[model samples]
Target: MAEDSGAEKTEQPTPKKLQDAAEKGQIARSKDLGTAFVLIGSAAALLVFGKMLAMAVLTIGQRMLRLDEKDIFETNSMFTAWGDAGGELIMPLIGIFSLILIAAFLGNTLLGGFNLSWQAAGPKASKMDPLKGLKRMFGLQALVELGKSFLKVAVVVGVAFFLLKLFFMDIMALSLMSEPNNIESALYFLGWLFLGLCASTSLIAIVDAPYQKWNHVRQLKMSLQEIKDEHKNSEGSPEIKARIRRTQMQMSMKRMMQQVPTADVIVTNPTHYAVALKYDQGKFRAPVVVAKGVDDIAMHIRKIANGHKIPVIESPALARSIYYTTKLDHPIPEQLFAAVAQVLAYVFQLRLYRKGKGSRPKNLAKELPIPDEFKH
Candidate 1:
């Protein structure tokens, strides 16, 4: 007969799996918007500062050097003019260098703060596959890239055309005017164009920012099959899982054995099962099962009890009841109270016998507390 496969596989993320993937640095990162904002603002400041510095230097040089009509207008003396221009250029170069430094600092700070890593960047089979490369070039990511390019082109063209038409209308109006204030009209038109361009570009940026982020996140999503494959690879194969399970069982047995010495009594099924119960009258109204197991664990429990001089009572039904129903460190249920009481009485009698006193049952007559719902 063919081996039976388990239930139909469905991809679901567990907390452990998510934690493992995060620890392995499988998440994506992007350039921080704050960094871009800082860079752009710094660049604008640098441009203004550069132009101001250039104007100041040029003014100082022209006043100080007093280059006459001979040097200013002579093409042959251009070399002399070039030599003079170099001094004026120094401030602009300084401004540009400062902008670069500021932008680099901002970008580095943003990236450092985010602490991003991509697991896919590590050596991986999929990254090396030709098929994966082809899929990336022709996939949803390609479509998103195409859409982005089209939108950018459309926005730029539309804004440019609108500004050009406005500029043309202002020029036509100025030409029709009886008193053509050429300088005033020109300055007003330039101001309007600058403001319009800034507004239009800002609108595009506002819309594109969120759209670009969504596209990036969508591209990072793993398929159901890919997630399953990753899980299998990271978590180990079925045989390895079985081996891990056996190791865990052994560890659990060891822990259970350690708890046996602390137990007040060992309830047993003679040879098959054992459950250790601990009770502190001030701390607990009823006994708590500390450890319980079957087969080799049961024998281990009995051996530990003997070593500790703790009484072991054989009660097959009580052993099974406590083993199945009570978890480690939980009080036994009221349903098994009567049965457990009898066992405790026998244990107390055994202790009395060992002390060379008349073996008598202490008050086993105390009734177990009835549940609230069962009371009148």
Candidate 2:
């Protein structure tokens, strides 16, 4: 029996089942990837901006502060100049800090769409788990982080060494010249260094972006057991589903009782199943099953049929077939043509039988002709 049951299970999932599973969590959220990119990019931007700001401060102090270049260079006087420059530097530092904060704020808001959950910072019971702590220490995530740090260090060191070599070559070329234009030479060297840095940073960004995205997705992967648990949680357990089915059945029976009053005929397996069918030239080309029920509900359908003066007929095979094959408010199946024709013929005969009249010729044949278009 267990082997038979196992064989009966479907291998493929239904569309509804797949949809229910997907709704369990955001498995493909791009926000996490975007936030990571923003954080890295912002750090790079701030570093570059700080370099530019320091250069600007030096230029301004030389001109606006009117401090002698020799005095600014002397050791004791340099300290005094630096102390005096603090007042001038304060506003620019404040502005730069404000800009950096604004950039960080915008980056987070744009990436994560303004999720302000303070509970994320709160203490959680899950954090107290010893197994979770062990997993954190020796996990795939830790390995990935270690790999990233190693790669970043290697890239930065290699790029810096290459830039140093290029700078040395430029410095050698400058020394060979009879006269070096100090400011122009410095500006040119800075430009080349900036260009090299930009190229190297771009390469790192390109490599890290896809790696971070893949890591984020891997972290969010649902195991087979987790998928099953999520499915059970979202769709409800078997007992709850059974209870819902029972409530739906009770409601269906009540509606069936109401519809029986308007039905033209009630076909039944006597005590087992009942199907109330109705027909009108404008509403239907053929008859429509308006109501159907079984057991105690079938008795209720029969009582309602009798009270409403609708014709009732016993057709055990037809009732059972229709109950299994057709739903409420649907046309009867083509396979039941003969059985349904017989029921309709019996219903027509009721009026003549009630008036003490003789049986009319049966319009329904044993082998009813099937419509050409209806053949499937």
Candidate 3:
């Protein structure tokens, strides 16, 4: 009921809302996740393929320095040397680039699955509005981003400081040692440095992913009115739906009453129930209940029957059974066949006698032989 303002966005996003947002390319994504992915991927690619690439570089250098006089003089040999150098670099470059591309793709998919949207790539005028940009730059998101940057810087700087302090004496001792020892020490330092960087970024990613998700959800929260409007759009508004139902019921009631005047007889519970029956030997094998009603509707049926001079039979059990068991335009069950047949026979006899063409029929069955089960 408190759906007054867009300000009260208290509802979590619905699936349809999320889907629509995705189509517009609105997704929760963290630059830190992508950065972490790229760093890890590049480090892995370089480590796995560094030896082969180093050998290729060494081979190129050797070829360049040791070229024969004939090779330098021939333009074709010169071109061949250049082609060999390019070929050597191509595989390593491709592998590294592919790793970066895969890292970016995976980072995005971690947040919102494999969603593709060109709309996100399109330019917008809002991006160029300096005031809007300034406002965003000073917004809570910007402050959060700034805090993340500071945290990253602090961790990296602190890790570097500690690593340097631990290695200060060993680094100085490197100068006094042989080349291989110094090289080994340097490699160990590089390994530790890479580990520290990876550790810091992994921590950042752990925090950033959830923050991005929460921020995205907060941005997309819906007001109560929005939820109601969405429901109305999906399933008609309640008021309109109720009105439609009422109109349909009235139309159905009118149609049922229209058939009452043509009924052969109106059976009743005398006060509580009524069932109008009609039979035609040519169009039907047995009697059909044209309509049925109770209470106010029963009284209305009696009034209409009286106006039309149609017979109204006060048989509580038959009326209750017909009202309960039979439907409009459908034949009564076989269980009621004998009972209905007797009523039809008496009506036929009474009609013929009224025209003075025959003698009055003997007393009709007082109870109409209604079944025990149908009696209630």
Task: State which candidate has the highest lDDT.
Answer: 3
Best by TM-score: 3
Give the TM-scores of the predictions, in the order they appear: 0.48, 0.48, 0.64
What digit string (tens of lDDT, one per residue) describes model 1 on residues 1-376?
1232332334445545545555556333233334344445454544456445546455655655776788677786767656657666776667766765765565444421333446634777877799989999999868866776686567667876888886787777776654224534554565455545544544545555566555534534455665666778877989999999999988987787888998989988779999999877899889998888889888988998999999887766667778877888899988777777777767768788778896655543333333343322
Runs in model 2 deviating more than 4 A are: 1-162, 165-169, 172-189, 197-228, 315-325, 333-376
Clashes of 3: 0
State in Å the error of residue 59, model 3.
5.7
Q: How do the candidates rank by TM-score, highest first?
A: 3, 1, 2
Show the lowest summed lDDT stretch of 10 residues, model 2.
24-33
Candidate 2, 303: how far from true, in Å?
1.9
Candidate 3 residues 41-144, lDDT tens each?
76666655555566667678778888687986887997898999998988877886887789878876888677788887888888899999999999988999
- Once fitted onto the true fold, the runs of candidate 1 whose alpha carbons sit more than 4 angstroms away are 1-169, 172-187, 194-228, 233-241, 307-309, 360-376
What's the C-alpha lDDT at position 367 in model 3? 81
Model 3: how far is 361 from its true place, Å? 8.1
Worst 10 residues of 1 by lDDT: 1-10
For all predictions, the C-alpha RMSD in Å is 10.1, 10.7, 6.2
